[model samples]
Target: MASRRIDVRAVSKDPTGQVLRALYAYASPDAGAPCTIEHDGRSIAAREGEPIALSLLGAGVDTLSRSVKFHRPRGPMCLRGNCEGCLVRVDGEPNRMACAAPARDGREVRSQNSFPSAQLDVLRVTDWFFPKQFDHHHLMVRYGTTINEVMQSFARKMAGLGTLPERPAEAPLPEEIDCDALVVGLGPVGLSVALALAGEGLSVCAVEEEPFAGGLVRDSLQWHSRDGERLCGAEASDRDLAKLRAAGVSVRLSASACATFDDGTIVIQSDRALWVRAKARVFTNGCHESVGAFGDNDLPGVYTARAAARALRYGVRVGESVLVCGDEDPALDALSDALSAVGAKVHRLTEGERLLEATGSSSVSGALVGRDERSAHKIKCDAIVASTSRTPAFELAGQAGVEAAQDLDRQCFASWADELGRTQRSDVFVAGSVAHGGRSPVRESAVARSVRDYVTKGRVR
Candidate 1:
């Protein structure tokens, strides 16, 4: 069977007359190999290193999974693997995150927790029947023991996620490693700190959960300005990575920090388990994009601004017509402009106008926008790109004995840190959005200096 390819425009000059490329620009053509993966018994062609979720979305396969209780259809909301919307089954492994998994030939992919199929799930009737809530714990409290037993059986069948593996799972042996410094995230701030520490003669290990080290820069459309010249984000990231390698920093991509111990031990998981003991640890895990609460916002066609950018970066077409809503931000502006440049009909709701409801059956067909109750208006669009404030990813910080407090101004939980990135715990440090709220080049530099001082002089200056 021939594979179906998504229609994507080639990289060309942007409206500014400058050449624009997707995530990374290849200098020379080297089409290494093509592979095919089976999705719901249909073969889909995929690139060597492209993510599996991108391949499915590009082929017009949305509504990857359904919610547990309500059976509400879910798709890729955050391409960063921060949400459970993209969970699917791969090669007998249930609930594997599709966005994080790479495409491989001959792999069997299936939608989990959905009866019949994800698109036409029979379990959806439960949503309509319940309407308000389904408290299974006290569902039949007044009934007799016989009725309670029957209800318990039905509830047990309905609850839980994914199918268990038929065969017993084998666990990989854990490997222990020791280093002078361990950086939890490989974003710009984390990279800066890792490079600075490694340059100071410390054995540094930098771990990134993504396939690459660019972080959010990989999905950005704008370029970074240095000395009044524009430099693309991918190019800048590559240059920085080269410098880190030269400074003898061990960079591990696709590795996740699963747990952090009080003794400064970090448990990392990739293909295998790894235990790293470091004298000093720095967290730059960044933040997760929050989705706005609105009617039917959990629909398959609704996506956060960051998720939209990521989809576009991987040549996944969001929609021919897009409706964007939310406050002003550089990322949102860039996404709108890019969509327009690609011939997508872009519609932006005015400031203070909120998304009232999204109307669709299987996927988003249109949306309702209004500033208030009296100003409601309907717009026809296949995709809705919504924006919301970012919440700092401070789970690892909290495990390390760092005190995090809510910042009302930023609307996110921020780790207590000085200007120099020193957290309440002397051994643990925080940088980037984890320490403060948002990204700033000046704050990155200050945090880097503080990390360097702490690593060299045993204290943050």
Candidate 2:
């Protein structure tokens, strides 16, 4: 990680190189005004729109904090705000997710939960005390109730989410809104679902957590077919966004659809609360990458494949020498190639090989990979990029009465919809990667048609 990009764009001159250039052009974050932020009272230079965590990682400030109870080192794992590895105090706000917070000028960031500093925490001795494990609830239970209560208090004090915010948060203004269809997430599937519905003359409203549409499209290699010419996912996103706006679809960026009530009302949390009662709901919440299981996998420099690609897409190299380990997939292969095209030396762990551990002190330096523990060998790397099948983001869908069944292969629960993307609930439907075992949904058009029919035939009129 460095303060400047590696400038690999100039070196790539081939056709693949041209494709990389186009992708990088689209994947990169807007280089906003130069700004400086204070980390633990020290200044770090960063741009306005880049995430604080990325800025810190680029500055080589990896150890975000120690584990809550064990005090083991922790850092950014997913880099998508889904993991607790990147929690830090931002401008007096305790337990703020660094990846989710932008690096604005004059922003103050500090390591939370750690005793003295994140790097040199005296409280890490707590991990040494518990060679096996520490159970605060049963620590002094046999002694007396009072002693148990005191132990619990000490544990609470040590858990360290820091403190309350400096200022109270103002309550969000609430609004009651109705739409023909409400779509959650704006990834490829969500965008397509929304587009199809709007194309059919149904009023569409789509909500995405990220400020941008096209979730992993810009960072990862995905393409769309448009006008007989293949467009990269980012280009597709731009075109689709324009088309959506032209069709009067309200695409709400930076909005998160959090819950659905028993009365079929979906609660979308953004700048304002939207109690959206759509005639039909299209669940396209997409999915989140998993870090998988391995020893010391929580180390700072280890990242999910997509997360590493996202950092690179933002023009930040997680490491100069990267190790990628996982079963092969088209997206995973593209990302590894992208890493190499941008100057990182990548080593791909072959099939049947498994990661035994990620070896590092406070951050990842190498990964131990092999078919079995006995044959495991350490491969030197500053970053370990793990590629695994993503898990469907099915929590919000569950609130909409979408049944999720456990998939043993991916080792997670996935949203299951009928052949037509109809969930158990009539008013709610699921599409895209959220269904079909986290694969492509069966024809987004069918899902959109189902929603449009609901809108036209139901009580909406």
Q: Highest TM-score, which number?
A: 1
What TM-score, over all chains together, does every model reach?
A: 0.92, 0.91
Q: What is the lDDT of residue 323 in candidate 2?
A: 89
Q: What TM-score should be assigned to candidate 1?
A: 0.92
State the lDDT of candidate 1 residue by residue for 235-313, as single tens digits.
6677777888989998888889988996545455556777888878889888888678889888988888878877766
lDDT of 2 by residue, 1-461 (tens): 34535454454633465346544565444456779999988899887878888888878787887788788888888877788888899988888778888899999999888878888788888877888988776688999889888888888888667878898876776677778888888887888889899988988888887777887775566556777877776676777778777888988887777777755454545447777778788888878877788988888888887778767666777788898887576777777777777778888877788888999777888889999989899899988888777788888888777789786656778787876787778888888777745554578888877777777886221
For each candidate, the alpha-carbon lDDT, in order, equals 0.77, 0.77
lDDT of 1 at 149: 93
